[model samples]
Target: MQHFPTGQAEHKRHRRLARRNANGIYNWIMTNDVFYRKVLAHLKHDYSKLEQHARELEQANVALEQDNVDLRNALLAKEQQTAELQREIEAQTKASGACTRRWPARRNQVWSDGWNRLTNELAEAEATKYREKSKTRRRKIKALKNRVRTAVATSNSFEQWLLFVEQEKQDVETLLARYKKKLQAQNRIMTEARVLARELRRSAESTIFNSSTTVNSWCSTFERGIAHVIVAGELFSTSPATSDGSSCLRSDSELIYGMSTLEGLETARRGSPFSRSS
Candidate 1:
């Protein structure tokens, strides 16, 4: 029993030393845990700030995309408008060129037509003048032929006719003077004839004559002869009178008187002196 009490005292002293060392180790572990917790909280705050910046950048990118789409649409519209304007300008230019090309041709055509019409009118006028001149020349030729035929008829032979024609040229001048006096006489006769005709017409209207055959016949014969002489004088003024002046003598009594008087005049003309006038 004495040995057992000594062993218990030593064991109690060793247990006290081991307990103090364990207390020191526990204090060091607690301090290290507190430091680690503080470091982790700081890292978490940095990560949150990075996340917020990323979200803002995504919103800005979306806005930029929308603005790019609007700009592309505006550019397309402007290009379409420019193309339309260019086409319109080209069409107008072509039309103007075509008009310019046709103008001179149209003007020339009008001028040519006018010139042709004027030329035709001038030609027609010239032709008309030529035709009129030809008609006048034909009339003159016919008159000259009648004069030549009358000259030939008044002579006995061709040689005599030439000589007679030359002599008749002087006689014609004298005949022209005589013709003027004859014309005055004819005018007086015509006046007398007209008065006689008027008296006859009035008598015919007033008197109902049952036997007017002889008177009517004589009147017709006298008028017809007078008209014939007048017409012959007008047509052949240069021709010699008939041998006994038969063309001038109208009634039977006048024919006898004219023949006697013309024969006396011819005898006198032949018997007159052949002295030349100065």
Candidate 2:
């Protein structure tokens, strides 16, 4: 590490003694322009970060909306499937007309007492066997209907599927609502960020305007002091070493100290010559 001389830092502090004005902060900022620029950079970084986060929230909101759409589409498909299932249940509950078309009856049988007076005994026996088989098939069909009715009454009822679909839809709605709430919150944050950024910009603008005004005022004051010094046109000199080994300034034999010393250097320059030539 580089080390400063014992008195070098003190001398530098002495050099900067008159740098500050009545407005302490503005003078310090004018002297150190780096601090002002650092403040600007911080504001810019904060605004950029806020904008980036707002964009991310917008993208997330879009994705969530798309997911909600997909959920709605799925719900539509489920509703269509449920409708088809209901139609199938109704069709199964009632016998189809296709079977009637398959078992076409003879028109002449009604004239002969509806197939009761058959000439061939073998034909009659075949009809009887057919009737028995049809009875057994009808009994099986009734048993299947009973099973289907039991299934409808039990946990496998249509209401179960409808309830499940409703539950899924409700869940999707809930998720969508939750996402909407998050999106709204993000929007609010983004809005607040925008407001904050605007406020920061205004604050920076005000600070710059105030600093410039202060700098102009300081310049005017310095000009007046320089004009007065020029009008005096006398050379000022430092005094002899005092008892404390510190030099006292004797401008026209006046002992000045602290804040007033910087403000009144012209009074000393008018009375004494700092350097004399033979």
Candidate 3:
């Protein structure tokens, strides 16, 4: 049982060992690649969703801004209507005052006395000659009374219209105030949504960047590992060419260097973003 393997058999064994190690590393690298790919896909999906949400928020803000503009326009129109109504009210008030002044209570007696004197003068004339004149005078007095009554009716109507207009103005003011409050609330909501979307987008981008960087670092490490394995295999295959121990020493040193490089990559990976949290 103290028999040693032949040189050819020993080389075959080394080849098998190297192949097995390479296979294991390849499988490990594949697993890590799949994992990182899944992570990247997930991050991309999350970022896409956040971007969609941000777009929706932007649309909502646009709608809100349009609504604010419409509200402001309506408010301006209402103000204009109110001012016009005020002017009409003032004009009506002046007309009503003028109508009142035209028929003053203190002048009522004077008007009656004048009418009586004119009637007495008409009666003193010949009856046949003054009949048509009396009829014309009566018609004139009736027309004057109608005019006074029309003025009074107009004044009353103006008062009613003024009251209605005042009520409408108050209602418009109330509505304007409500619109202002609603517009303010909408603006606040829009601002908050924008801020939330911005923060979410920033966070998503940062996370994706960090994840991408980590994946790249891991990929580089795996690539270096595969390269080192290939070089090591080449050295082992060539080692049989020389009958000196230096070949084995060189292989050992290359392995040590590869291990040290792997250790450094592992250290770097541990210092990555995700690892920092852990």
Candidate 4:
């Protein structure tokens, strides 16, 4: 019975020790739980800060992207403008080259025309000088012929005088015939020369007139082209024949008839003078 009592006391002491150990474990667990909760709260705060920083970084990236896009667009616009300017410059250069080619051709034509005109003028002046000199020579020859005639008329005895007069008459007749023949030849030559000169002058005048008309036509055509380009339409409606009817060319028959009548009048006057002299 005393041994059983000691065993019971040992069991009671074991129960008290287990109860104290359980209480200590409960206190340590509660303290650990508080520390864990504090660690969780700190982790949550750090996560929120990281999220805010990420959002700010995203906004900054978006802004940078927008700026980059704007810069790219500006660069593209500048490139397009430069390309357009280059095209315009190329077109202008081509037009200028064409004008340069035409200028030399026009200048050469003008120079050639000027040279021809100057040559013609020089020839005409030389011909006029020759004509004036020929007229002076003819007047001098006429004076010499007149002096010879007067000397023949003045020479003095009856048979000697008669022989002298007959010889003088023969000499005068021969001289007069020679003078008349020479004068007729000279007149024929002068008339032929005058006709040739008139023909040459008329030819030169016709050439000049035609050249001037061609230049005027070219100018008018050029002006019309410019006007058409600027105003796009609205040129003259009338035909050229109708517009210039007053300046129309006459028939060749009409011209011939007029010339023939003039010739008949001239012939009549010339024959009247010859008849009166006879």
State which candidate has the highest lDDT. 3
Model 4 pairs in collision: none
lDDT by candidate, in order shown: 0.56, 0.54, 0.63, 0.56
**Global Cα lDDT for candidate 2:** 0.54
Number of the candidate with higher TM-score, 1 or 2: 2
lDDT score of model 4?
A: 0.56
| TM-scores, one per candidate | 0.23, 0.26, 0.28, 0.25
lDDT for each residue of candidate 1 in 5-82, tens digit (9 for 90 to 100): 443454454445446667654444444344345444545565566567667777777777777777778778878877
Q: RMSD of model 1, in Å?
A: 27.7
Q: 127-204, model 3: which lDDT tens digit per residue?
A: 856788889999999999999999999999999999878876776676566546544544553444344334434444
Better of 1 and 2 by lDDT: 1
Overlapping backbone residue pairs in candidate 4 total: 0
Candidate 2 ranges beyond 4 A from true positions: 1-143, 146-158, 211-278
Q: Total clashing residue pairs per candidate?
A: 0, 0, 0, 0
Q: What RMSD does each model have against the real structure?
A: 27.7, 85.9, 90.1, 47.0
Q: Whose TM-score is greatest here?
A: 3
Model 4 per-residue lDDT tens digits across residues 1-278? 01235434644555565577886655555554655565557667777887898898899889888988988898898889888889888988988898898889989999999999999999999999998989998898889888777666654245578987788687667656655654554455445434533443443345445655534443443343343323211111211122224322333433443344344334333333233346
Tell me the tens digit of each residue's lDDT in model 2 across 180-210. 6545544554454344334434433454456
Q: What are the runs in model 1 whose C-alpha is more than 4 Å off? A: 1-97, 155-278
